[model samples]
Structure formats: C-alpha cells, structure tokens
Target: MLAVLASVFVISMSGALMPGPMFATVLAKSYKSPWAGAQVSLGHAVVEVPLILLIYFGAATILENDITHLILGIVGGGMIIWMGLGMLRARKAYAGGTKDTPYNAFTAGIILSAGNPFFIIWWATVGALLVLKIADYGLGGLTALVLTHWAVDLIWLSIVSGLVYKTHRLWAPALHEAVFVACGLLLMGFGGWFVVSGVLAIG
Candidate 1:
C-alpha cells in the first residue's frame, strides 16, 4: 500500500508538471486569484471523482472505445480551442486590473479538464489500471488513490500559481498581454494536436 501510494504520487506529480491546458489556465488565472490553483484543482476533482467512480463500476469499456476516443478528441479539443481563443480575446481586459471572479478559475478547471483528451485518455488507460489494482485492497486503497492524486495535483498547482501570483505585481501591461498570449497559444497548440489526431484516427 505504501508503495502504491508513493508510486501514485510520483506519477501524478509528473503529469501535473506537464504544460497542459490546466497548466496554461493556472498561469493565466493566477493573476485573478492567488488561490487559483486550489480552486482549479477542486474543479478538476469534480470531474475526476465521478470518472474514477464510473471506471470502478466497470465503465472502462465504454470509456476506452475507439469511437468514444474519437468523439472526445473532437468535442473536447474544440472546447479547448474555444477557451484559448477566449483567453486571447480577454487578454486586453487585464490591463485595467481585475478582481477575483470567485468561480472563474473553478469553472475553467472543470471545463478545461473535461475538454482535455489527454486527461480522459490517461484515466481511461493508466488511471483505470490503477483503479483496478487498488480495488483488490478494498475501499481504503481506492480512497487513497483519489485523495493521493488530488493532493499531488493540489500541491503542484498551488505552488505554480502562487509563484505566478507573487510575481504578477511586477508585470508591465505588455508583459501581461504577452503571458496571456503565450498561455492561450499553448492551449490552442494542445487542442490542435488532439483535433488532428482525432481526425486522422477517424479516417
């Protein structure tokens, strides 16, 4: 069990460090809320908890189907692209400064996460395997997996967002826009890859 927990933490932390849609959102939203990382992680949990449950109950087949992946890649990828474009459009608004929108980062977490093909794919495969393996140890192992995953995500995301937030005061208007643009483009790049891969798979 200790080995499982440690392995899970290492794996989750490695993945959390990757520059995914969530990471990009963390960078952008950190300016709005210093606690954006925790908020986003909570939002992500909203999707992840249910997903883990579904997988636990034997829904992995449906989740792993090629057709499901195709649809997820197309639809989720489009949502991510839309978010990237939205961020670009709203970049100028930050120049005037902004307040915490409360649910802003939270919803971004849920939506961006739900729309990420890689997130879905990970849960469908590696995550699903982990779920099954934990099942043998009963509910305790399963609980550990969920909490462990979330904890790793929370820690990593909080640190990243905190650093971004702390340095935000030094950003010039141009720098703010530049960061937003970079983050937005990063999201679009990920979306594009998912979309293209999905399309090719369909062919």
Candidate 2:
C-alpha cells in the first residue's frame, strides 16, 4: 500500500508540474500581485479536489462508455484552444500593468480550471488506473494520492508567486508577453492534438 501510494504521489506531482494555461496564469498574476496569484492557485486546487475524487471513484465505469470519453476529449481540447486564444488577447491588455485585480485572477483560475477539458481526459484515464489499483491499497492510498496531488499544486503555485514577487521589477513586459504567447501556442498545439487523437480513437 505504501509503495502504491508513493507511486501515485509521484505521478500526480509530475502531472501537476506540467506547464499549461493554468501555470501561465498563475505566473502572470504573481508578477502583478503575488498574493492574488496564491489565492488563484488555492482556488484552482480547491476546485480540483472534488474533481479528482469524482474521477477516482467513477472512472471505472465512466471509461467504459464511448460517449463519455468522446464528449470529454472534444470539450477538453476545445477549451484548451479557447484559453490559449484568450491568453493571446490578454497579452497586450495586461503586459505593462499591475492593474489586473486579484479577484480577476481568482475568478479566471476557477473558471479556466473548472472548464478545462484536457484535465478531464487525463483524470478520467488516471482515475481508472487508480481504481484498478485502489483495492490493493485501500483508504490509505486514496488519502495519500489526494493529499500529495494538492500539495504539489500548492508548491508549484507558491514557487511561481514567490519568484514573481521577488523579481517582478526586473521582469520586462515584452518578456512576459513573449512567455504568454509561447504558452498560448503550446496550449493550442496540445488542444489540437487531443482533438485529432480523440477523433481518431472514435473513428
């Protein structure tokens, strides 16, 4: 059980560390207001907790349904592309200023995290894997997996917020914009890939 739990923790942490629109948003907000970025990160994880539980508990049956995976894949992919586009648009508006409010970051984090489609697919797949192995470890594994995943998220957000707080003055607007655009492109590329893969799987 301990080994299984440890393995899941590592997997969860690796997945959380993968850069995405969520990470970019956290970093951007951190540059403007570190506290706000932290808040946003917390809110994002808060939303994810229930989702992970749902997926873990339900994926066993959920994955068996073609319709479920199809809807999830399409929705998730579309959402990533949309968020990438949004970031691109936001580049100019937020580049030079700290005027963006914490509430804005909080709200955006919640909405984007909640609406993200790729997360849905990934969790659904991973959740199924957990469910299969869950019986081998019982409640202890479950608890550890959940805790470790959230901890990773908190740590990542803190790092972003701390770095921005410490170095915001030195960070140039152009560099920020460039980062945003690059992240946006990466998101769009992944989204497109998901859509294509999902379609191929369905066909």
**lDDT for each of the candidates?**
0.83, 0.67
Q: Judged by lDDT, which candidate is best?
A: 1
- lDDT by residue (118-192, candidate 2, tens digit) is 565666677557645765576676777777667777777787878877886786778867866776677677667
Global lDDT of model 2: 0.67
The lDDT, on a scale of 0 to 1, for candidate 1 is 0.83
TM-scores for the candidates: 0.92, 0.75
